[model samples]
Target: MTRFNALLLALLAVAVPLSLLAGRVWIDPFDPQLPNAAVIFIELRLPRAVLALVLGAGLGTAGAAMQGYLRNPLADPGLFGIAPGAALGAVLSFWTGWAASGWALPLFALIGAGGAMALLGLIAGRGGGVLLFTLAGMMIASLAGALMSLAISLSPTPFAMSEIVTWLMGALADRGWAEVWIAAPLTALGLAVLGLAGRSLDALSLGDLAARSLGVDPRRLQALMIAGIGLTVGASVAVAGIIGFVGLMVPHFVRPHTDGRPSALIVPSALAGALLLLVADCLCRVLPLQGELRLGIALSLLGAPFFLALLLRLKRELA
Candidate 1:
């Protein structure tokens, strides 16, 4: 592991325990008199923390891979339409009252992600350029977003509308080992797939013709990106609603510490993403609000400013 990776790992070690102990009702790990400490730690906090780690790593790695693949510093995993597609699925679950079922929501979300992935591949076609691929993804995202809005507008009941809106805001409250089980293996497999495409991403960083000359197969790389991103981003939305920006912001935070190669950036970005999400979730738990803040809203509040700063920086550089 790189020093950056080691640093993130160390931070995570401290943060995980802190997250478990710090919540609306604080627990004293050392206090033998603390009631239900084990139950709180095991039944509630542990799974939520694990889910944060898994999903954050997935988003972070996806963001790094996306920026490298498109050669655009501003690129995000959501740009591929997979997230919106997944969100649409989750919204549909609410609209149809299936969200009350244990597995229906996630299953619908995964199916939506798969549909988006298939559509992206189909529309981009074999040998499509990066620009075409990106545009196709954007189109799908727009479509999915529209569909979700329509679903909300036509929701059969006020309760369904309320549920849909709240879920779209995103949070980790009440999640359990079941959610962790659903997301962990998928994210791990997605990470492995992205890692396999690392060398190709490095080559593509040099531009399309140059990468082709270097024997990087665009079709294969594209497939890997779609599959990897689909699984990671899909599983995340399936389990945790629509937590955003980890993928977009994480790579930028970690990139300066790395050698600036896409291959070298992935693992460190994953670690940093995990750390960022874990800490953010803890903050959400501890904040003295009417209720815990939504994880998606908190990140968007942080990321929108970060994104604006990047735009300003880019503008200055271009000028």
Candidate 2:
């Protein structure tokens, strides 16, 4: 499993750079237009690939942390309503024209995600347990999605409505180094926090009573872990809108290599998440289509089927 993870990481190292060269505008090094090509490479292509890597890893590691803490296979930042809350914030900012204030889009999105986390915790209540928390997440996510739909339905103009729709669908198009810088640091910090909590998560798998018997403070661990996820996944949602399934799928993909150790899944899932998104982003560039496929749409097309398969597998296992 360790060897497999190492190989995957090595492949990702090569894949990310290759993705920069995958766009529709072909760059010839020997051509007289090389300088223009270099400009495009530096400005657009590089940022897009870097974003897929950073944001993807953020979602992945955040999901792993959430799943480990909850001891649930269905746990994910998106599923838990964090990303949708962020999306609602960004969409509201755009719709109401409040994002004109400097950095309001990302700021509002972060606040929204944090708000959703708080709301979820509140609904879960004291000692509510994982089942109650998961149910609360579903309710919160549904409410957030409904509110977004309401905003779209009440949009003042067709153009505004279109913008809302496009933003919800998500894209990495035309993003620049500024977006990369904004997301990268927040994600890195969150990942570091989650990494430090890895041992705590391992203890958690033994159940709360056993973990406490071992001197592990389960509540403190849960709070810090949730905070880490909010920071990391919120940054991703702020930048990328609502790219789902990376969080949900990456941990499952790496589960085998982790030997079922949820803690061990963290780094590998993060790496795999980045790799998957880069590959998907590369396909968005090279695939023949009427218009470039949105990253969110492309991911949904891929992820939805995997989700169904996962459900079926669970059913069979229970059977």
Candidate 3:
């Protein structure tokens, strides 16, 4: 796992720079012939690359924390209403033309995510039992999805609906530094709060009684975990537009190689997530498609097979 973390560190250094050097721009790195090429590189490509890395790392880290806490590999912020709630916000923005200013979209998305989590907590009440939390999240996710569908269907213009749908497919296209700045603070704060979550989760692997004997309060950890996931994942969704599977898949990709130690999976999982999204974004840059490929679609195309293989392996293990 340490070696894996070291490898990821080296790769992270190269990932952003290489991604900046890519995109639809055909300028040679050595020879700057295109007018405003440098500006384009700085103002456009640079931010999108940074957004990819930041958003990917956030999702991966949140996913690892969630799986550790819940003891469920499939546990994710999306499973709980965060991603769908953010999507609802983005959809509302498109429907009402609020995103014409570009800044309102992410802000709305963040608000939506926060609202969903708050609503869940209010309904489920104190003590934060796992089943109650899970159920509340499902309700919120359902509500958010329904609202999003209604927004799309009721949009005044067909073009607006198409715009919403395209954005929902997700991309890092033409993102700016302002978006990165907006998402970074919340994501970083959440990451810091959950920095020790892996170790806590290691303790939580024991039964609740055992964990309590060891000074681990499940309720406190649950609250911290939820806050961390909400902030990190909500910020990622606000910026990245519902890029799925990275959270659900990254820990699995890194876990087996790391001696199957749950706590040790966190850092490597995040780095692997960064690598996955960076490569996906770079591939989207070169694909010969109208308006380029959507980042979420590109990821799904890659990850669906992996998911199916995982299912088959689980089936065999059961057999």
lDDT by residue (tens digit), candidate 1, 133-205: 9999999999999999999999999999999999998888899999999999999999999999999999998
Q: Estimate each model's TM-score.
A: 0.99, 0.93, 0.94
Tens-digit lDDT string for candidate 2 (93-171) = 8778876675888888888888888987788776736677778878988999999899889887788788788877877
- Candidate 3 similarity to native, TM-score: 0.94
lDDT tens per residue, model 3, 274-293:
78888799989977777788
RMSD of each: 0.7, 2.0, 1.7
Greater lDDT among 2 and 3 belongs to 2
User: How displaced is residue 287 in candidate 1, in Å?
Assistant: 0.5
Residue pairs in collision within model 1: none
Q: CA shift at 244, candidate 2, in angstroms?
A: 0.8
Residue-level error in angstroms, candidate 3, position 146: 1.0
Output the TM-score of candidate 1.
0.99
